[model samples]
Target chain A: MTTLTENPNVAATADTHHGPAKGLKRWLYTTNHKDIGSLYLWFAFIMFLIGGAMAMVIRAELFQPGLQIVDPHFFNQMTTVHGLIMVFGAVMPAFTGLANWMIPMMIGAPDMALPRMNNFSFWILPFAFLILIMTLFMEGGGPAFGWTFYAPLSTTYSSDTTALFVFSVHIMGISSIMGAINVIVTIWNMRAPGMTWMKMPLFVWTWFITAFLLIAVMPVLAGAVTMVLTDKFFGTSFFDAAGGGDPVMFQHIFWFFGHPEVYIMILPAFGVISAIVPTFARKPLFGYASMVYATASIALLSFVVWAHHMFTTGMPLFGELFFMYCTMLISVPTGVKVFNWVATLWRGSISFEVPMLFALAFIVLFTIGGFSGLMLAITPVDFQYHDTYFVVAHFHYVLVTGAVFSIIAAAYYWLPKWTGVMYDVTLAKAHFWCSLISVNLLFFPMHFVGLAGMPRRIPDYSLQFADFNQWISIGGFAFGLSQLIFLALLIKACRKQGKPVDAKVWDGAEGLEWEVASPAPYHTFSTPPKIK
Target chain B: MTRANLVLLRKLVLVVFGMFLFGFALVPLYDTFCEITGINGRIIVKAEDSDADKVVSDRRVKIQFLVKTDAKNEFDFKSNQKFIEVKIGELSEVSFEVKNKTSSLQLAQAVPSVSPGTASLYLNKTECFCFSQQILQANETVVYPMRFFIDEDLPEDISLLTLSYTLYQAQSVQASYSKSELDKGAS
Candidate 1:
């Protein structure tokens, strides 16, 4: 058999030449999935920073008993825009970028199934976010209604710029749907021969499921936003009480899409963690088949539990009970996945590598978040907790500590593999410890304040909740500042100055990706690798 | 059958099973589709404007806005030039002014169309805004009335109307951006 260099294939040929120096055209008109993925990752990182700045503002305003930094109205807008940016602009796209970079390498495909559609998806995000950000300058300011965009709030009393918010959400939904389609089609149709479905990596499997969820629910979100626009501007009464339409019906539709959207953010993280945990622990993933089934079950149960968000909006007793039970049922599968993660690390070579450290924090912290979620699932308790800082704390724990932590962990885990150089291990661990401690400091007290009868989305609170708010603000600033260390670690890794990494850095990695060379290549496994 | 045929058969079974699963998944969605699109139990309320019923409460009278398209100038409210009615369209808003001639602090809520009862707008207590709650501090007189018209697409044929208001003490739930609040802690 001829060597790669002797045969002179595209990858070997390109390696010989300097090719084009990285410049503007290399970004704009490129079809390289890795290049495109890097672009997406950097874009999401910037949006995350912007969204985090908004969070800092929100925390600053809420630092004391009375409104200290901003008016209640502007605070409301900050919370609204923060949720929108994080959900649509940051977490989801970050996962998609990871998928674009890793999935083809993992599954032994040369490129995504629909590369041009992939390009369209990535480019649409910047413009979509631009439109949304521009709405802040519109007359009467950006959407002050909460991110849920409940009716009567988003409708009758909305600012004139609600139309822009609606259209921007439409573009974002389109971008997500197309990106998901690319991921799914590439996985289903382009997997290298012998890479059987059952033998595929968990990251690919979880992402496959996530892509399906995106395609299914994003359209519903689009439909919901379209109705909002029409109701506000075009005089449709889809949500007008005077027109025999109930305002609460909008919540029903939005969360039907939204609850799954939450799953979309984390399912890929589940895949990433599943892959990384076993690699570090030196154990086969405990209950691999069960992990796959559990993900599917979580995605399925996500649909029936949307109304748990609307429990306090006054549904009938039966409706409340149905939603509560359905919401609680999700814990079964979620519990299975969590149990498997711990089981993988049981009595194995458990090293606190930077990626493993973040994953470990995610396990403990996300479980705390999950337990709070179960508490919130109880309709009776949720009534007391609804629209309170407690609910805010619960989701931030799930989202920030859970979803955001997993993204950071995945970044560290793959940074060496992606760059062919190890990251600053000491600095990486410091970032993790700081994040873990500060994030808890930030979100933990919200439970107490919320339980003390403080409602959410308010700029000020009663004097009783002041001390916890002060502690929480300190934690928020530390958490925000700690992320700067991560940015530094990433920049250092891209410079490729650490120890040289092997093709498979971890001892027990069992995927097609680790079987390939480090730093991957512009094109890899073009002829498809044999799975068995 | 050869091994190839066996593999083909398994693939066929899996495809069929997937189809069944997908079809099962779609049943509830089909139901939700019907519910959202009004193919299922949907109720629509329409207003038929006939004429303004001049109801006299205490010592003053109030005129309700007419939602009738063909009701030919029944109420003599001052904004009649802007009031156009449709046979069967949306509900329109209408209001009339009543003087609190007595030297007492008077409060009122501009209660309109009882079927959907109460205007959706947050009621602000300002001196002269047309038939919302007018709280006149003593020895002061203010106009209490409604400012609304019918949604121009009300159903034709029915011709009856009732406008009601209740006078009571008012408390504020209005959350507006104050300039001081906006500039809070800015120094």
Candidate 2:
């Protein structure tokens, strides 16, 4: 339908015939999706380490209760920035990076539809985060209002850093929107001649839906942060209850963007797991159509369930029930997904490659997170679990084991394709096992402490929680160190230290990405391959 | 990638812009939603131009006043009368005494909420100090007046309604009231 289709061979020859430009300039000025993809992945890894460092501070402070290394205010900043960095900087970008590296290849298309815009999106993230990080050194030490940044705490009581925090988040939102738009346009217009809708890879499918979700919600987040800005600096009382605006209203608006924003993080992981599970199991994904429908349903349900986050905000009885039931409804489709994954593995020839093993862990751990989420969705019980360590444990399971684990799986699954060599299996497996065990050690007891009435986001706790706190801290440190192993594996593979491999790196691998050469070339599918 | 797909790209851009506007739209939308559902406990009733259709029922509901202030607020605020009994749908009046013990011009904003939660929808205030900030000159003691009527539709199971006002001291709260009229016609 475009000039790219006019003379496919010419387009292929022109872009692919030349090798990548040299040095740092390739990364600085490049529009190639693969280059941009690598940039996003590496940047996210660094941010992960930075955010993880903050978590270490939090765990260390909580290790034995009463004020130790850092003061309470600084501890608040640690929690706030840690959450902001991990959600926005690490997980979201890593998934987008995956989308960039893999989507065009999987769909047999030539590059993302708007490659230049893709570069711009990936580039802006570091600067946006810099603006946010700049806040810590500012007068009041960053936003201590928690990542939720609820009203009054973010407004009347916040330090001068709020303006900078708002601006940083705005730039990040812009990057996400541009990135999302490019993904949507590429998937919509650039698929190969015969790669019809259903035949597309599950990763491509999940990303397409996620792109729409990003477009829909990122602006809403922009709106939320802007209100926070105006309330603090511009003398607008959009959240000040004394000024005809209710603080509780901010929670409603924040979660409206917030709920879907969460799905945006996890849905891509769903697609990643969908791809990895079947490949290792040597079976077509069971309930394929149901999986698609379930993803869509989960996205739809995300919009309605935001208020469950605000159950304790004194919302009307009806609203609490409505949101609670809506949240519970999400588990239905989520349950469908888990059953489908297990069904795909039923008595099939399954091998525990690193990717498959991570995917399996994701299924088990994310389900635990989901079940806890279900428990929280009950309006009455949520009153108990609302801000406790239980809530912390619940999300870490989903985000770490669920989203982060899936990302690690995707990275391992495609590493050979990207690097043209097989990474050291023993080292990778060693990294995996260490991470799996330590992560559980780190997060599992959070449920007990949380359930035992230990509130989250606090610097120190009473003597009763001191024992659980120590074990949880140990887990936190171990999990943080284990990520270093994955980094070494990545660095070694990138340096081409592994054994060389041909196309179709894994024997059970399917789809168009596997059909391409190992190392994937500087350009992929410049001439769209006929599907069928 | 293609001409037709460029059209899709354009539409997606529109969706992004539209959702941005929708974000702003949620403020008014949430206000409307809460107003309709009587959730969020936001008090937004204007002086009714006319409630001549009101019916005064025989059912008696005791209205109690609860006042609270943040740590910084040292001003003395309390309803002069501890509690008052009013028939359902009948207009009733009560007075609150606010003593600005602090030695400077202060803008005090009072936020109101009703207990039993559902009572917020039925408790209509026609004239109240919470309608706007009460500006008090140094040590100016103002006894503010409030008038209200409970809707006849007040459910039978509720007999006691607690109307609470939370006082906040602010240097400025998004308005500029004239100093000359600060104490006009108040006791």
Best by DockQ: 2
Where is model 2 chain B poorest over a 10-residue stretch in terms of lDDT?
A: B178-187
Please give, as one word, the docking class of candidate 2.
Answer: medium
Expressed as tens digits, the lDDT of each residue in A94-133 for candidate 1 is 8998999899999998888778778888888999999989
> Scoring only chain A, what TM-score does candidate 2 earn?
0.97
- Model 1's CAPRI class? incorrect
> What lDDT score is found at residue A32 in candidate 1?
67
Against the reference, the lDDT scores of all candidates come to 0.73, 0.86
Model 2 bad stretches (over 4 Å): A1-17, B49-53, B70-74, B169-187
Off by over 4 Å in 1: A1-21, B1-187
Q: Clashes in each model (backbone N, CA, C under 3 Å)?
A: 24, 2
